[model samples]
Target: MSERVMPGHTDGLITLGAADALWVDLTTDSAVPTASGAFTSSPAQARMGYVLLGGHAVATVRAGDGRWSVSEGEVRRAAAALNAVGMDRQDLVRIGPFRGAPRQECDEEAPLRWRRRITGELGGPERAARREVGRPYHLAGIDWRQILVEQTRDGTHRTWWLPRAVVRLLDAAEHAETQARDAGDRQTTNPEGPTATPRPYNKELEGQLYSVLSRKPGTSRRVAGWACAVCRGAPATVLDHCHEHGYVRAPLCQSCNTLERPDHLYSNDIRVANRYTRLFHTDTDDWLRHWHRCPGCRARTTLPLPHLAAWTAHIACRSLRPTHRAPRGRKPCGVLRVSWTGSQNAPRSGLLTVAVDCCPSGEHRVLAQVPYREAAERFRIWLAETAPALAAAAGPDPLDGLPAQSRPVIADTSGEGLALF
Candidate 1:
């Protein structure tokens, strides 16, 4: 043991032998001081040893021969000096000279005191090994002074320098772990977790299947089936659940999952519409009109119309649409005729027209005209059949001003003589 170093002790650097360890004696006024200081001799040394003198002090240690002095106002300068000499928190080993205060007093004041000292002496919590101990000191009316020791290794001899690369990797790993822990904490605290349990269906498996299909873009049913079986999901369009667990898996295609429901199936319907739209490079509106239905409400209304324009823009940028061509024998359906009549002798009808000049070569030209009411009915039926599971899953419709069993239909009819049924 050596005599305690005073506040204005002479600044000096020294090297320790292989069998010897450097020691520091720190003295301060209170156990929780506002400022502190440390000293080291060599810039290369990474570890140090510390001892408490008369007064109490909080101390951090590292491996090094460098010497430093810290106090209420000079703690930051001392730490900066150590950093300027290439010494960091990882180089520290132990801290001492602390007269432990009562747990209540420490709990209230130690954090604030520690935070300030850390800011000045250790940079932050990341750089130091922290400890608090109650030990008797010779000095009177003084609580403690902060002291630090660092360590490094050389060959078989333990010294105080930590490799910079190791320090960096450890820091990164610590950061990643901290982020993951934070995410887990948030998940646990979320109110929705208690009320809305995630439909446990193996997202990783689904992602794997998505990866396979996304790679080929147009894989066959057999290939898709094999992949789906391995991935544990339904095919690419229909919704499947674990029969034993009721957990919803990824959807299968309509051709693959033939189950139908009397009500709307929201999830399956959305999946099917989105899937076929991706496959055909067609707009969501087109997919919904030709294939999709609402499972929540069993509605055949243009489900994708709201998102159609955005989807179109996205797919267009991807160059997914086919080139336009002229029809072989008929023209293109470019014009639509709508008629409305309020008289008893006349009826209302809407007719769509085809322009023969714009028809694609070798393609058949057929005019597709339907009554608004009929279209609506077809859409409802499509929804009930395509996404039966979704309909069941939804339990009940949430929309306002709509019946649970029926949906409104649109009628498209020409204003002609009102003689026919």
Candidate 2:
């Protein structure tokens, strides 16, 4: 490798005496030092007095009395320089005025406050690289978190011992760079797509769509006019493709395109008593599957009030089958369903139907029927006052800790288990 260039002047010398010290910058070779008062010192002064240094280096020993007076700033600078060169404790030549400061060498571990700051700056422990003594290696895919730079000399793995504050600063810089790269990728992938906050945008999905569109010019225009096939309301932002068939299925909204997965939806369906439905389109002319949609735009089809869904599912599933699994048809029993009866005007009325069907036969027993407005008010009350008490009773899923791929799929025995509409 090439020699590392150091900053500042590097041709200054320090000469210490009994009463004072002299710092001389070498302007020319002819410039000679004249014998001055108290310039001649004892053997102690000769051994420790003169230090030939690069101009940037500071002599920690006081010239007047030879007292150790090291400033915190100078100590910090020395630490930073050592870190820059990837120098460990063994490589530390000297630091500050205190040459025999054993306590300072032992205090390498950072305090709790700095540790937490470093962790937060690096985006938690998941993103932080584990510091270990090992053979030198290169970074793997998406593994750039090892911001603590290292350098080797004489064919050995060099490690740096930096101050906590300096390490935290390095981690913060890494995080900023990562954020900038992600932002740039987002712009290049989909400049006109939805922002990532309130509505998350999948950049990978958008990039794939752009790649496919580049291969087929007119196909982009055809899909551009199509609405989200899943939601049927939002503008189609991504080209949804089937991995099994390796064919472009239909254009879907950001949410539908990103969140739709058969396995995940199936798991969620089991957990939430099949309240939310996932739509799948096989072909252009194939009958479009429908989920509950808003009366205005027919876009909002996701489960409403998820806090209420868990408790309702728990009670309903138990009442129907006494087991975690629901009955064959997957129709949730003892659940509330709101229906509008009259015209959509001032005189309109609504009904709340509560039904339960436990047996295999397609017969449901209506337990209660009430005005929707009154029932809605009561539902809000129950949600606030009763839900908290039943929260723990809902408990965790049996497959909570299992990996998604390892979790067994609960096969639907009934043919009508999946809802087409």
Candidate 3:
């Protein structure tokens, strides 16, 4: 078999395979001229500086010390060893270097980690205000290995993706910085220069509420039937709408859509909620609290909500695992595009948005914006009419079958008042 050279990198040798990349230590002369060691890869030390992870080698190189460099032949040996185990080179990107992050306090023993604190948008589903950090948080595509390249920076040096933890941590820090910069710019930008003052959202929402109530009462049918998508605990009492174009968005409670957030809703937040309250859910909440793996395809996703138990049983009866098999139907193939039209044609406080990339052939389609309350209520009515038998046939609540540890609960959002977003 002929060897394949990495494109644009003729000098670099690409190994055949590795189940996953491995981190190993070979030796090098330090520019500092301070350390010493000569053991031609000594016997596998039980408490040695490193050990084999799974079936590949991993060097435990501590920070801020020793000759942390290795030779080219040693590099080739490591690569060959990894290839022997089936790790692929195509899955790698040359990200950057492995320098310790700038720090003010001494945290010498601290392994790099990233904590993602979701500062949600105005009218978005508020997760438990969690800060999900990672040193491999089990999100898949994250079980990466660190490959520290030991090379002299004598003009022939290059950077690449830092092993595992630091790559994710660096991404997190950069994202936080970007968010900060954006917030600062928004706060300091000349309001009268180019940015027009946003129209007051609450006033318009109130006007829309009054108009809708004149026809019905309290809230729209969809909004009334489904719990607040944001908090997931309270009954939806308000219709989150687009302030500028007067288009309805989703069903949320006053607590979630509080006036402090004088801006639009978050797309992800609404999408997560819609994933539950819409036709089929793909998130862990309500009926399907934790995500599950598809036995057929191994692709993981959350089941639809408990309220949709009848429907879920219906889907399960069909035994459709589209990710792996054919004939079993999956999510309806279509697109929902919400259009923000001219002021004269705008509905009473709503959002005109569109969803794309839905069809099997990647087709795009447009859907009319309807009151979220109405949509939710329609499903509720249908479920009431036909869900009992289907749900009964489906057996007990799926939650009963799950281990207690796996159950996820909706967060409490009855706090006195936090900034809306």
Question: What TM-score would each prediction reach against the true structure?
Answer: 0.19, 0.20, 0.23
- Model 2: lDDT of residue 27: 13
Q: Note the Cα lDDT for every prediction shown.
A: 0.26, 0.29, 0.28
Once superposed on the true structure, which residue ranges of model 1 sit more than 4 Å away at CA? Answer: 1-181, 184-359, 362-366, 381-421
Error of 2 at 182 (Å): 17
Which of the predicted structures, 1 or 2, would earn the higher TM-score when compared with the native?
2
CA lDDT of 295 in candidate 2?
15
lDDT score, candidate 1, position 175: 28
Clashes of each: 93, 0, 28
Error of 2 at 358 (Å): 7.5
lDDT of candidate 2 over 17-85, digit per residue (tens): 311222211111111111122122111122221211110122233435654322223323323332343
Could you tell which candidate, 2 or 3, scores higher by TM-score?
3
Residues 227-294 of candidate 1 have per-residue lDDT tens digits of: 12212222232243322111233443322232211111221111112233343343323233222223
CA lDDT, candidate 1, residue 222: 25
Winner of 1 and 2 under lDDT: 2
- Poorest 10 consecutive residues of model 2 by lDDT? 135-144
Model 3's TM-score against the true structure: 0.23
Residue 264 CA displacement from its true place in model 1, Å: 27
